[model samples]
Target: MTTTTSGPPAAVRSVSPRATVRLLGAWHTTGPAYAALADALRSAVLAGSLPVLTRLPSERELARALGVSRATTSAAYARLRDLGFATSRVGSGTVAALPRDASRHEVAAPPPAGDAPASDTPSADPTTPAADDTIDMSQATPSASRALHGAYTRALEALPAYLDGGGYAHLGVEPLRAAVAARYTARGVPTDPDQILVTTGAQQAIALLATTLVARTEHVVVESPTYVHALEAMRRTGARVVGVPVGDVEAIESVVRRTGARFVYLVPDFHNPTGRSLSADERRALADLVARHDVTVVGDETLTDVDLVGAGVPAPVVGDGTDPRLVAVGSASKSFWGGLRVGWVRADPQLVRRLAHTRQVLDVATPVLEQLAVTDLLEHRAAILPDRLAALRAQRDDLVDLLHERLPAWDVPRPDGGLCLWVGVGRPVGRALAAAAVTEGLRVSPGPLFTPDGSGQDRVRLTYTRPAGQYEPVVDRLRRAWERVGGR
Candidate 1:
């Protein structure tokens, strides 16, 4: 019988030798050097760091970059091809790919190890096991707030008012825009409805801002181990991402000055993974530095409301929020319900219009029902936030206590706000531990997933978004994984 097969996939783009080397973090564990290199490459491919169809640097080039022999690099490439994490073509050289038989449980790249919306977490492929089968420690978002259902129900009652008009709300429905603007105004940053552009989520807000402000071959300064997906959005604009130490305004200024970077992305309120918030002085310094450099700043406040210590969320990075160069993104997914997919951008009215126009090519509008629900939820936030905070605080405390009890060697710092603890595992075994976790039916986001240059090999982010009851199992799984990986 004759059979037909699809043609080989073509490489859309090439990752540089430097970037390829960065992705292979801590590959020198006890194993054959080539096998170790191949394993690292395979892990990166499976983790979605080296996305499928990306052309790898040539073997010789990578060998030179990695300080390894060309034969080692060649054998590593061959191993990658044998395991189906890569394929070769005549002109494409080597490209990342997934095996045809790869299972869903194996392939869904772990979500960025930060405060991204739970709904945005990478999920198993269609053929993967059920949700109950795996302990997902990647996404740092909470369950739907208790108020979400009532808000949606009210939205349904209010839906008919928009039935007569086209559902397209390119700038978002007026109520949601006004609600979002009012919240920003109350947060000490005066805002008007026109300055608010509602998006499907904070992620979409970031992408919209990236598309609107960033240009090809420009520089975008970011925090090291910042929001990884934000890096993806900025890089998609062909902008080079330059990372500085988190919360270091001096480093930020230096990078901006040296690179002449016109764009800056910060998670100043409560940083993901690390769960660190910039001090008031740091915020002021960042604001002044961005202003001085004529830099456009995107302050991601997705986790601003996840206050475990009740210290109240800090002010926006750009305090005034009127600067045309300052844009702030907020999301209901982290605070209320990920399924809502509701978020907003607060920026200059002109930029808001530009974003709305640019967003049309991507999505004409966020769903009107979701917008109305978000509006209702925001209006009732006073009733909802306390309960959400209480639950998170308890869960966070429980996870911390459990980790301390079970994994005493790891340094687990308590974050004032934000959903995850960025724990130091005392060894560069994040990738190994994550792999081991999977064998125990747990999925994790290792440290490398959070950084642009793949330098956080000694860390792992663990979210307390899971119920308190599951904290023990989560710790148990992590403990077993640590043991399996021989974590110090």
Candidate 2:
């Protein structure tokens, strides 16, 4: 009886088991299933779970483990290889690799030394650094106008006769010059068409001024945290730039008196990066000091029209009639659009002629199309300006609210006008924070980019031109980076 029972049990146990098939989820079975899987893997890699050079699972093993078709797994692996995220060998299977993005290497590298030369220097190649999405807060520019198309169209219609004339005159279109002069008059600086000389942009205006005024090794006074590019331009002309502290009238006056500087470069209207406007008394004092010292004041009013806050603030160029030493520079680039590329220097007629003659050696003249476009916008200023001011104001408020909510540690002064907020990081981590931000797909203009001699390492200028939706992510990323750098 025991033998019979044992025999039956052995036969039943020896019977072969049936093969079973398992189904994969829709993500694995779809036409682009491999792409979906590769994306998932990419997310994992970006999250730092799988570090660079780590070996990935074998295609066959992964397919079996995930219950997916071998072809699907192979395709996913191939996709990763193509993206430079993985590499495969006949015997070694696949291994994670560094991302093909050039910026990845930059992020991984140590922060640059504080005194490193600017990337824009003539000898320096900007393209050498693997191109990353750079958030350039160095410049203060406004967004394009909705009415630009109409303005440009009108300009094109008026361009035929203008084109027929000899195009090599260094002075810009007479009408645009008149328009610029009219703007100066409207702003309380009385001027004639003969007083304005249009240039390629504010940059060109600065370059021309610097070249014309500064003799080799001449002393040029600039605010301590002035626009770096302007400082560079002045320096390029062999001018010894003297930094004068802003916000305090006495500091600037003291520097002016002490240096006997030939020229003073200033941004009086909601001063760039700092957002501090000089009081009327301060402006009067500055004008008096410049007049007394015979220092030619080159007033950069690029941000003059971008009055988002402090709407009642007085103009910075109300010169005392005694001196007539002020050469005010205004640009449509910031008030309207950068693509307009139209700017004018408001000065005495003789000085304008000199600048025009100097400009002939550089750019023959400002583009006819740009000049006309700007003229049209200036003509319709009443209709277009209110909307622009309103939009900019809203953007400024939105950015301030976002900073307050997400990055309470950051001390951002709400600027009266201008497109950016000069933020105080309270520590010299601008470079480190910027490096960390790149890893998270954020580009920030470190404060040193604005300072002469690569100072201001504890600050960064943040623009509000980005719409509210775009602005939020930037703030979040910056907050994360700030936290990583132990920001206060």
Candidate 3:
């Protein structure tokens, strides 16, 4: 039943007819053979007798060897796929896999940093996650929506008055700040224009906070496998960043108390790598932590508006900006496009004034034209998000289907919101797979790249931000890459 990959030739193994019959018990006593066979396979998978990604017998091959009709065999395989216990790879055919366990949440925790995969494993030459002729799956950004094009057209119309001035808006363009503040008020967070300071992007907003809030060698509390850029920004400020896994607010609070962290950063809404949100209880607890500990909290809301189909809105961590200790960061990047490069920080007016002066040292001011465009986009966001959500929903489903059909061994969790899927490929070969994929012209980020302390070698993050048509070619390239890995 088991065929091992020997030294020279790592042969592709298919289940023998005899072994297939043995693995699956008699089905004649059940209502129907196909359904019964599918159930048996599921049992085997759950029992761990058949490890993930083990190739199954082909429909015709199994039918011929088992004396069953080909239609019956095909139905059995199809049923297995529908139930999530099996998936098909192009060359690999149907493979055994673990189904989604209802008891377990898809938003699993990042393992401890010391649990990193062994480094001595054999691999091809390392390839960058993105390069020429590669299907880029590294970054979690999407193209500018049609709303952005319209916003740009309107921005040009509003540009003349600002053009006559010196154009250095350290406090940002006034109208945009007012518009952004109004949006926050409408969302249950009342705000004032003076409390809003615009930056080039959310990344810049965080970068500025890294400088203003963090003193040298001070401790900063952050999510371990958070947005990689956020980790980098924390380090750039000479801060000793302590990381805790998501879903555990207590761990963060413990760190804050133990280290007397000057600032704590969290992406409570649609977190980047895992695409999960804090539970309502957790959010309330977080607000309490901010008040009781007298600690400054930075709430990153970049992915707040990107809530996927059927995933309802999460309670904002710092709603209405009422808490003096909380600073909220909002961005048009995730909702509209990164190319617009406009984001803002909502805090106390005095803090805003101080940061605005500090920001003057960074880049003087955000571009006035882009700020105007963002204002117009904010005006029409209600109309735009629904269409955008519908398209993204379809694209997410397509990517899931394609991944199941093309890379059967991979454990793909269905994320309810955000642009990316955090996946588990069934081996300690994320880096190797990514490198091989790049050689086959597909750019993918391995799991270890996201961890602050370098872990998660069996995981990969995939973005569904591109067009629907793009998924097909990407999966095709991935299939070829998987083939190359098996052949080696």
Candidate 4:
């Protein structure tokens, strides 16, 4: 006799309600514990689960809930504050602040049904990916925890003595400047400490340079499909950006001559997105053209060290000492950890001084702790290079192989170095593909994101920086999405 003893229909057996605070599944435990917590929260906010003005639990409550100490919660909140994600008043508990784009939300919605077959005619939703889409090969960043944390830890231990002062200045701590100069000196460019200006990151350095050098309506030459953020920076300064195809020295020269541009931004080593490096001849021609046109050259060498194929290319020489127009940008973010936020600009002493002054007004100074940490990494550079290079090479190879196997129709060029491969999808399906990828729980930077003029509609930049395990799943998704979109 099955006794129906339920008073309210056995209380209607149901699955447990999902947690309001969903921790990011992809977060790797590294760096500071507080940082991990902050990143998890940030991801949630970015993903739109935690909407703006949502009241977060108290520190004690969160600590207990997350199984962490209250101090950890406090530190995590502090990090959130630093990143502009939360705010606290004297009496009110911490509340969620909107991201830069306050109106954006990441509310979970059901994925769109598989779309119909792809045609040469463009779809209404250009960013939708096909149903069988597997890999999201769009981001261009290194995988987390490349073992540089050990170097950073060692660096931190040696930093106590240097923390004697108030630690606020725009020129950066002297030791870090010296260390950066030494790196350039080792790399064939003889640089002095005076010629180095420490910045928060390569992005900040680019912004400062743009602010100081670019005037409203002045023309700036950028490589087609150049670093998107850099292009944005140029636009922020109200500069007219003209794209010269990467590896086309003549095209760049013609633009420089025609526009009489004040500056030209070039990525000589493993150019972003495309991963094409300028040949020795092209670099020389670029330098000569800039010199003849009296235009400043901002050489971004952020991806200089991730060389996976053949002998590493030589750094571009911007002519003799008298040339005050060449500025080289370097960063520890790509080769090391992005959290370090330490980058330097190598230029003439006068120009460096000017940039330093501009930096003073903008950020006052980069944190001394991070600067010291990067300085230590630079001093022990030999110990870290081999591991970094090996990890990146493995990732690049894994991605390339996966793409070939699953995405045979996609034209994925094998990059010689850097963390990303620029893939051509044979048609202008990038927007559709990106939108579709997001529905499949993948986020990607569509090709048009990199182009200033919304061109490159057929290309996508895929990062090989995720874990090896992620490659197959991503590719599988891409394959499924492609098939659903009727891969030609």
Question: In order, what lDDT does every prediction score?
Answer: 0.79, 0.68, 0.74, 0.70
Candidate 2 residue pairs in backbone clash: none
lDDT of 4 by residue, 360-395 (tens): 767888888888778877787677778777777888
After superposing candidate 3 on the true structure, give the runs of residues whose Cα lies further than 4 Å from its correct spot: 1-132, 480-488
Q: Worst ten-residue run, lDDT, model 2? A: 11-20
If both were scored by TM-score, which would come out higher, candidate 1 or candidate 3? 1
User: Ten-residue segment with the worst summed lDDT in candidate 3?
Assistant: 2-11
Give the CA lDDT, 0 to 100, for residue 64 in model 4: 76
Please write out the lDDT profile of model 2 over residues 329-397, one tens digit for every residue.
888887789988888888777887888888877778888988999999998988888889888888888
How close to the true structure is residue 337 of candidate 3, measured as C-alpha lDDT? 90
Candidate 3 on 50-117: residue-level lDDT in tens? Answer: 43445677889888877889888889888887777667755556766545552121222332343222
RMSD of 4: 22.6
Give the per-residue lDDT digits (tens) of candidate 1, residues 378-471: 8998888998898888898999998898789888998898988888876555666676677666888887677665556667888888877778
Cα RMSD of predicted structure 3: 15.2
Q: TM-scores for all candidates?
A: 0.74, 0.71, 0.72, 0.72
Task: Give candidate 1's error at residue 180 in angstroms.
Answer: 0.8
